[model samples]
Target: MQNAVLAKVPYGEEGCAEQHDSDLTAVIIDDCRPDLSLQRFALQANGRFKEIVEFNSPVRALEAFATKSLAADLILVDFRMPWMTGPEFILAYERLAASYKPTPHIVLLSAMPGAELKAYEINSRLLLAVCPKPVSLDTIETIVGKIQPDQ
Candidate 1:
């Protein structure tokens, strides 16, 4: 369910989606529904992305990647998900052909502490960052700041 408080809040101009200037496609993968809704809202409010796609499972998200359906510019995935961890997903994603990989930034969101999180650090090429659970608007800004213009 979308947060009632956030529903009342307005974004940049009129509210909600306003055809973000960046025109970037952002994909969010999370097993939790409420968290997914909030993440979508945060990205919408940032006004940097054109489209936001949600996946409840990393496995389903991987399927999208394999089928060339998801051409994401920014990806936000939960680290601890059933079937595939975010790092594992990144590793599998890296196996796709060069033409299949369009995403420039991939963020892993986790509630796991530093030590445990370090164990999953595998790819620096595709995985751009690691963020905390319940991603806030500030976190969204920081992630967007990392995205370069050329990308």
Candidate 2:
């Protein structure tokens, strides 16, 4: 599964230049495979993110961060997962080596009502917003607009 998924995206040592720019490396972590695919498609269609990396496992996503293979300017994380919750992932993400610099803008996604507000209150500094499930293009655009372009 890992090999197949990795092949779909340019996450190798020699990353794909066409897939990324200096502005934003967006990572989406969700346990639902279909949801992951949907998010990736939406982001690609919107054409804002320099790169879009999808992980069905929050644990693997963290591993990517631990190895410095993943450097994100924007992160969209599902609030509930088997391995770890969204808040827990955020905590672990904060401890990653890539996090030492300016922290990435994180948006938590959940089906629970008012989850976004709660997530923002928990760590407004890192979390940009909380979005409901079935994330929309408008929501993605709104969040992307908040991020300053690379100088």
Q: Choose the strongest candidate by TM-score.
A: 1
lDDT of 1: 0.74
Model 1, position 65: C-alpha lDDT score? 76
Summing lDDT over every window of 10 consecutive residues in candidate 2, give the lowest-scoring window: 3-12
Q: List the residue pairs that clash in candidate 2.
A: none
Which lDDT tens digits does candidate 2 get at residues 15-119? 232343445678888888877877676666556566778887778888888877667778889988888888889888876744345468889988877844464
Task: State each model's C-alpha RMSD to the native.
Answer: 5.2, 4.8
Q: What is the alpha-carbon RMSD of candidate 1 to the true structure?
A: 5.2
Query: How displaced is residue 103 in candidate 1, in Å?
Result: 3.9
| TM-scores, all models, native as reference | 0.82, 0.79
Mind giving the per-residue lDDT tens digits that candidate 1 earns over 90-139? 88877773555344688988888878888764755877888888889999
Q: How much lDDT does candidate 2 score?
A: 0.72
- How many collisions per candidate? 0, 0
> Positional deviation of 116 in candidate 1, in angstroms?
2.4
